[model samples]
Target: MKISPKKTSLRGLRIFCVAAKYRNYTLAAEELSVTASAVSHQVKTLEDELGLELLTRERRGLRLTEQGARLFRELEPAIANIDGIIAEVQSKTAASQLRVSVQPFFASECFVPVLEDFTARNPGIEIFVDTSDETAERHPVSADASIRLFRQKPTQLESDALFPLRLIAACSPDFLKRYRKGQEFTPLPILVHTSRPEAWNIWSKATGITLPPATSVVRLDSMIAVARAAERGVGAALVPVPLSDNWFKYGALVPMFDEIAELPETFYLAYPKAKAEIAEVKSLRKWVLDLFQE
Candidate 1:
């Protein structure tokens, strides 16, 4: 017989199952923390819904009828499996650890300052922030999510854009004054991040301004290093906005030109599609997007 879920009470079904397992309403009620009368009522309700005599009383005590035995055999394992699944889900949601791969520059400049608040709000989440320079280009194998610069949204991963990347040619106030010549800073050495050797040319082309005539190029591996070199008046550097805001604010660096070169690359929070709905991943996605979204 087909059983209608609407007509059957899960509580009744559970009570019946427990009573059948121990062959005693008193024993089942003790385990369920209910009165024996409550257990008998539940079993009677379930038997009525099923239209079958599920239990028989005899001199030897309670015994399952043929129909009851059949139901118990099928329902016991399914109920046990359901319990196991519930336990697994609760375990996953209760204590979670997240591994995030973040660009080293962004981590130091933006993320670290606000990280404490995130930890405080999600005390159950243990987050490992991997800020190694290598995470700048790709998501780390061990990371549940990553923040990096991408020209476009990754097709294979779920992504959220934080902000566009803008580069400005900047130099120390002293360097600008020394290099100024006839309203032009040309002839000054171009400080460049080694990863983007053609950065100056790209900026120059975007702004329609000619660069210095092949002067000595100072190349550094990281953007922070390039910005620091520019701060020391070594040369003019193509520095990113927001990240370089403090440097420009305190006069450690000043824009050499009024033009800001916008790049297709943008800061993005990305994670695997398979882990998109994971609790830890979702928490990070929401926190990061809320914190950094422009």
Candidate 2:
């Protein structure tokens, strides 16, 4: 058997390998940062130069011809070996890196402590903090993970149920005294969350306070704002239980309504759809779930 020098080229072989592994030229193009047409042309050139059909194009997608399948089986191990060698070589020269993003409020109150544990264990890991609603959606695979607070299902993220939390009304001591008077604190003036305007609405329904006045509401876009306002005796805010831990500990704020308002919110550890289950990621997820043990 004569080896045809013109039959095989390394560059064409790599492209064909990716297309074969993914079973789609478009996806292979995406990974290779070239267009589908370019990948298709490369595959075409390879088949023409070798005088063999590699793929049968179908309406659904490309399928490897029998000849191509035999070739692929023979080539797969070589490709994988090259990949392993490349990884080994790069590992010796580069630092390990992981980037995680989190919602500001959840990061400040809930996730940071858990992260402290991670850093203590993973001193070599460099972390990046991103605070943006876009990152919240998990688009572009920007972060390794995120902790989000939501009343309903958060779109575009693969989420794990960390904890279902209840809300409580809280205010500074001065506000309670100023507004409670000698009336035994019946019908407390409300502190409201700005983002969730319905917080007051939910509280009213829970306490059976029929006919609540429109003037009895205060709103702020962020929980931190509402927490600060309530801490300053601005008004009582219906803040979620976990987020109020700091204020509750320092006596800066205390619960107003003795009856806890159960909200439809849950804290979730969300990540890119692909990265949700690796060993380190799973460790962090379980650590978070354990953080809020009942």
Candidate 3:
């Protein structure tokens, strides 16, 4: 079976190689963000083309069959060549303009609306994003700049404070009037992200308002999920000020109380120590800082 490049994806090859080397489909799946079955399918596809048994399955996990070890050793150079090509492409792209990584929800809610505005102002630079739930430790070091929400001096990166963070209690206003109409704001489901487990407690402490033991407390992994649940009247969510403004403006959710807590937290514009000197990166950093100035 001749494996044509068009017939198979590079992803299948990479996943197969990683699984064979590690002898763990689960580990390969974790790295690739897929199910174990998906990894198995890719590896099977590779094995079918090569006419070989890649692994012998065990109750614990995979153990390499004789053919698998030989295949793995031979494939290492192919993998390294692919990696070099990828790095070359990325480096060329990186040199041309700005590469920014931002927290996903914040990018959608806060940064996106004004994104074209930044582009308009800085016509010389192009922007790319590596958006995710949160910044990985090496994230700032990897990109020209990062838009992040947390309060810490990232090692080696220069940070310009964007805004002091504001977290507010919010829910669908009509939900309040309809579901819990006559009752005091006591019993209501509360949606909190895992990042801020004590949000309600902190807000209550700051405002000196004792909310009744919550009717429901659901933990979510993302602010977007928390905000969406609150929009659907599934629960109340503590949302950052930057996000709340857009949601309320669009009639998605309403601030439950006017009292906002200034989280000892802030979002910052951070860039790698080396990349900060690049013209495109510097322009974007200034553009972001000017938003706060206005």
State which candidate has the highest lDDT.
1
* Candidate structures ordered by TM-score, highest first: 1, 3, 2
Better of 1 and 2 by lDDT: 1
Whole-model lDDT, model 2: 0.69
TM-scores for all candidates: the values are: 0.66, 0.60, 0.65
Candidate ordering by lDDT (highest first): 1, 3, 2
Model 2, span 1-294: residue lDDT tens:
978575478778878987886678987776466899999999999999889999878888899999899888898667656654654554456665556667667777776766778778767766676654422222223456677665666543567776666787778988777666563554545656555767777777877644334346666767778888888877767777776788789899877657777767676677644455444556666666677534
Clashing pairs in 1: none
Write down the lDDT of every candidate, Cα atoms only.
Answer: 0.81, 0.69, 0.74
Task: Please report the TM-score between candidate 3 and the true structure.
Answer: 0.65
Worst 10 residues of 1 by lDDT: 133-142
Predicted candidate 3: what Cα RMSD to the true structure?
Answer: 8.6
Enumerate clash totals for all models, in the order shown.
Answer: 0, 3, 0
**Best-fitting candidate, scored by TM-score:** 1
